[model samples]
Target: MNAHEIVAAVSSRRASAVEIVRATLDRIAAAKALNAVVTVDSERSLSDAATIDRRLQLGESIPLAGVPVVIKDNIWVDGWRVTQGSRLFADFVAPCDAIAVERLKKAGAVVVGMGATSEFACKGVTTSLLFGSARHPLDPDLTPGGSSGGPATAVAADLVPLAIGTDAGGSSRRPPAHVGIVGFKPSYGAIPYGPGFAEPFFGISVIAPIARNVADAALAFEAMAGPDARDSDSALVESSDVDSSDLRVAFSPKLGLDTPVDPAISERLEVVVEHLAKTGLRSVRRDPVWPPGATEEALMPLQHGGLAELYGAAFQKDPEQFDPDVARQIERGLSLRGVDVIAALGASSAITTAFAEFFREFDLLLAPTVPCVAWPLAQLGPKVIGGKEVSPRVHAAFTPFVNHARLPAITIPCGCDGNGLPFGIQIIARRGRDRLLLRAATRIEDEIRALPH
Candidate 1:
């Protein structure tokens, strides 16, 4: 069941919270091969469900009353282990709740356990040196994508109806695309990260939602959105109702000419554009020029630089203990001087300005969430796409820049490749236009679902 149905059932006493929690636990245990859930506290989870049941019997309203939700291991929950899928901090237990976790609890959601993430959420694929790796639920040999791989795997496997994760780049968006679920990365700070980060990615990262459908994703997003005093980045922004019928969309198969995309994925995008044209879009046309230096190559300094700032010292002490890719990124980050970061920030401003101008003529921008389908589970990303050598950040090509621009973006399942792995189409809007982006996503989501699987 989806979160809404679970809530209704629990509230009406058709399904007690304890019973639902027990069933969910059973599912998680049975799906061991997926290795999606890294840590679980059954006793506490059951006790929390019972508390919700008692409150419900006494006549209380709980929006997510009996729903079982999994949290990405990186997100702190009071008294739970938050390893961030890293061996370095494996023994550390959170002393307090992240603002996102607190909001989920207040909405009556039960935290089942921590899902897997890449070490410190530093990579696109979910493999790590600590918690191991998360496999795609549908195909055990393939990956779920990361650093939110475990959350996407759990939801895809029906281990939970909803999940909470963090998206610095496509940590949330890309994995759901691989796992065939909904991943929504709300605008920067739309969901706060207060008391959780001694130093965050400033304007880049945000807590995100992963679910089975657009509406459930939206429901989870609304529940966690809004400002928190502890979060200096938080601010109130009213969500306006948006209708796709009134909006023109710019569609890009490859956001840049040099970007590599699989031919099959490109064909799927063609099918999507054809469907959107039939739908009531004001107009569907190819995207015009985006700002130069705004591509994936431009954002690496900030992403890697921020990682170095957060974990470089620790990595230097024990390079062997860290994930090789993460350690390499930190080394690269350490090499960049302050002037390099300043130059990247200037380019970020340029990219943001480019999008601002683009949106004046279009309400949404659509592109492939990833260039290819889920590759082998052991690899970080495809070494090559369309016969060209891909950069380590290439898999994150269409995604990380969105975070740099501080915009809201979502990836919805569109179609699957020949191997039955899912493909995702992304919809993006100007910063603070999250509601509008979601509205269009739900509309396109229907067309995507109706397409031949």
Candidate 2:
């Protein structure tokens, strides 16, 4: 059942919370081949569900009563072992619940387990020494994308109705697109960040919700959003309802980046855009004019430097303990000069300003969530796209800038490629316009669903 259905059934006593959670646990056990879950505390989850049942008997309203949810391994779930897909943290147990988990529990969602992530939630593909790799539910040989792959896989495979993941550079958004699920990244600070692991992305990362549909994602978002004294970046941003008739949408196939999109993906998105235009929203083919140094390459210093700053000492002592990809990032970070970090921050600021200016003329922007569909799990990313060899980061081309600008964005499955692999279209809005983005995404999702396959 979806979160709403589970909530209604449990609240009415038609199905007890214990029954729901037990069945969810069974599903997780049966789907272990996906390698999507890192830890499952069946005992704690059942206990929590029983508590929800007791609360309901006392006449309390719970927004997510009896809904089983998985949190990304990078986020804390008090007492749960969160390895962050790295051996370095393999033995680390969380001492307290992250703000998101605390809020989820308060809303009556049962924490079933922790989802897998790329080591330190840094890479785009989910694989590590601690937990082998997370496979795509649709095709086990392919990946679901990462580092939110575990959450995306769990949701898409129907193991849970909802999940929470972190998005620094498409970590949450792209994976859901690959797995054909809804991933919503709120504006920076929409959800209070942590009492957990130190963030490598620092100011850019936000806790995101992953679910089968936009409504479930939004429901989770509602429960987790709002300010907290612990997270100075967090604030209460009232969602502004969007009027469909007055909305201005822009469709940028490549997000105006000199990125190569798979011909199949490009063709499919064009068709989706055509359908959206028929829905009465004014959408034009316009791309944001990005500043010269706003590309993902220019922003690497922040990630590398952050990793070096946080884990460099540990890495220096034993680099083998870190993921090879992450280790290289740390090594590069260690070599970066202060001016290099400063320049990257400046570039990020320029990207933010560019988007702010772009939004002045457009209420929403649509782009392909990823350039290609799920690729072989053995590789980090597709070696080529649109008949051209590209960098491993090419799959992430359309997404990082949204995080860089700290804007609200979401990815919904739009169509399948020739191989029947799903791809998604992303809808982005100005910071603090999360409500508008979700509402528009729902409309577009419905329109896509109605189209003949």
Candidate 3:
């Protein structure tokens, strides 16, 4: 069940918070070998659940009363020992909660535990020197996707129905695509960032949610999103809504670049588009290029700077103690000069602006969440999929740009590829247009039947 169902189920007395919490603990225990979780504080969660039961018995109401939830280990929650999946701060217990976690708790979500992540979420794989690696629950030999993979893997394995994760560069989106769940990142800063941390130098990551499906993701998004004194970059409240019908989409199997796309993904994407076409939704072929409208190929250089800015504090504390991979990323980020950063920032702006007119013409942009299904677990990155050794990070291309531009994008599980790995179709909307993205996502899911590869 999604969070809403979980909340309602516990509320109507069809079940108790203890029942939901118990099942989650069992699933987490059974999946212990997966290592998708770095920590599972079962005792604390049950104690919180008992408190919820007392509230329900007193007829007191809470929005998400009795809901069991998990948060990516990166974000802070009081006493959670927020690891961010790196050993640098491995011993740090947050003095307070991240704005998103605090909101969830305020809405009555019982904090079940925390999810695993790639070291500092710098790499694409969910492996770190700190907590080993997070493997796919379905096939341990394959990847569970990165950054947010731990939380998503937990959700997909039925460990918990809702999880709060952060997506800087497809951390939230691609993981769900890999694990066959829905990951939704609202326009950046929608859920607010922190009193402890601030925005990255470049707009590359945000606190987001992963759930069993789009609707549940949206509900969680709603519960967590809003202006907070801490996150000034959050979208301003406006009178707008997601539409129910008459959607316009730009479907690109490959996002206009001749990358090595798996045949399975290419074929499955077409079927999804074909189904959408049946609903009278206009579909077009447009190259929604990354870096938006910038003429230079500069995502990596610019992203590195942001990486350093976000995790620089850790670097100062214990640079050598950090994950070697994460330290490497910081070194690369710190090496960038002012001119390089300025050029890259300009390129990002051009890219963001280029999409302005495109978004006006298209209500939603549709593409495979990743160019291909999950790669082998042992591989560091794709060796050669479509005749090119694409950056492992770029395989999950559909999401990062949205994060960089701070736009709302959601991935809905349309169908699976031949390898049995899930391939998702991403729906993007204007900045702050989360409702529209959610609506189109639901329509596509309802319309598309499972197409066997």
Candidate 4:
């Protein structure tokens, strides 16, 4: 059941919130063998649920009254461990809740526990000193994908109907696509990260939802979105009804990026595009009008800047303690000069303008969420995909430009690769157009679900 349904059932006394929380705790236990949860605070979670029940018994109307939600370890949840998926901060419990989390709690959602994230969410793989590694629920040996891998994996494995994760890059979406679930990374700053950090990622980190399906994702986002006085970047978007008619979309097999996608996966995605074609929303096979060097511009520099900023202090404390790749990333990012930073901003702005114009002709842009099918867990950073050597960051480059543009984008479970790993197709829209994007995505989602496996 979705978060709403579960809460509805509980509120109506059909089932107890205690019962739902117990089932979720049990699911996490069964999934403990998969190593998906970094911390399972059953005692605290149940106590929170008991309070929620008390409110319901008093006849208070709460939005997420009985829903249990998991938060990524990087996000602050008062009194819960906020490890940021690193041993460095393993014992660090938050003293306050982030604004996004506070909003959810105010609306009556129960916080389950801190979900695992990559160390500071710097890398694509989810592992830290606090928790070993977050394994894919579908196949324990493979990655659930990262840095929100734990949130994605747990939701996919049904530990929770909803989870909140952060996406500076594609951490939230990539994991869900890999796990055959749903993820929504709203335009950057759609939800605030206040009560922690001076400014995260120069405004790249978005508090996003990893959900079982699109509606739950939307509901979670709705509860968490809106401007908080603490976060100046959060925009004011008035809620409006969503409709399906009169939409135009452009799709790229590969967005001119030299991706090493498996032919079988590509074929499966083509089938998905064809399924959407049946909906009569105009589909244009126009070439991508992305700015020159956009693919390259979005990749290395940001990765370097992000890593350098996230782990530079770690390198100072003990160089040998850091991952080699992470160490190199810090070195590269720290050395970036003013000109390159200026050029990156220019490049990002140009690409945003180009796509903004492109969207004037198309309501949405559709593309493969990632280039390749889910491969061996041991092979991510080393393997050759799309016939070119792919490092971990390049796999995430396509999704971050939207961060730069602050556009809303969602990853929908489109189909399965031949190996049966999930393939998600991304649906992107203009800034602050999250509700519309979700409505359009739901149309395709309904169709995708109807297809025989």
Q: How close is candidate 2 to the true structure, as a TM-score?
A: 0.98
Q: Any runs in candidate 2 off by more than 4 Å, and if so which?
A: 240-244
Best first by TM-score, ranked: 2, 1, 4, 3
Please write out the lDDT profile of model 1 over residues 237-296, one tens digit for every residue: 555644445677888788644688888788998888787788665345666467766666
> CA lDDT of each candidate?
0.85, 0.92, 0.77, 0.77
The lDDT, on a scale of 0 to 1, for candidate 3 is 0.77
Worst 10 residues of 3 by lDDT: 289-298
TM-score, structure 4 vs. true? 0.94
TM-score of 1: 0.96
Model 1 lDDT vs. the true structure? 0.85
* Candidate 3: residue 302 Cα off by (Å): 3.3
Residue 215, candidate 2: alpha-carbon lDDT: 88
Residue 336 deviation, candidate 1, in Å? Answer: 1.6
Residue 233 of model 2 has an lDDT of 94
> In candidate 2, what are the lDDT values of residues 185-237, reduced to their tens digit?
99999999999998888599999999999989989999999999999999876
Between candidates 2 and 3, which one is better according to lDDT?
A: 2
Residue-level error in angstroms, candidate 2, position 28: 0.6
Worst 10 residues of 1 by lDDT: 194-203
Error of 2 at 426 (Å): 0.2
